[model samples]
Target: MPKFTGYVSDHTKFIEELKSKTPGMEERQQEGRSLLWDKLPISLDEEARTRESRLRQNAYPYQNKF
Candidate 1:
C-alpha cells in the first residue's frame, strides 16, 4: 500500500477549524444570496430585436486588421 502525505489530513483539519470559527455561516450565505442574486426574470424580446438574428462571420478572421 502507498502511504499518502499529510495534505489530505491537513485540509480536513483546516476545514473543521474554519467551521468552528464561523458561526451561522450558512444563514449568512443565504441572506447574501437573497440580497444579491435573487432577481425576477426579464423578457429577451428587446435583445432579440437589437441584435442580428442571422449568424455572421468572416471566413478568415485573422486576415482582417484595422
Candidate 2:
C-alpha cells in the first residue's frame, strides 16, 4: 500500500494550468479589480453633492400627465 498524499481538486488544477499559460494574468486581474471595485472613501460633502445632483423619476413614466 502507498502512503496517501495530498489531493488537488480539479478546479484548482485547472487554475494552476491557466496561470502557467498566461503570465501577468494576476496583475491584470488586480488592475481590473481596482478599476471596477477598489475605490477611495468619499467625504460626507461629496456624498451629499452626489445625492443632490440627481433628478426624481416619475412613477408610471409611460402614462402622460394629460
* Top lDDT hit: 2
Candidate number achieving the greatest TM-score relative to the actual structure: 2
Clashing pairs in 1: none
Runs of candidate 2 exceeding 4 Å displacement: 1-5
Summarize candidate 1's per-residue lDDT along 1-66 as a digit string, tens digits.
Answer: 977784577789988888789998878889999899897765698667657676777888779667
- The all-Cα superposition gives candidate 2 an RMSD in Å to the true structure of 4.1
Clashes of 1: 0
| lDDT, candidate 2, 1-66, per-residue tens | 997579888999999999999999999999999999999999999999999999888998788998
User: What value does the lDDT take at residue 2 in candidate 1?
Assistant: 79
- TM-score for each candidate, following the candidate numbering: 0.37, 0.84
Clashes of 2: 0
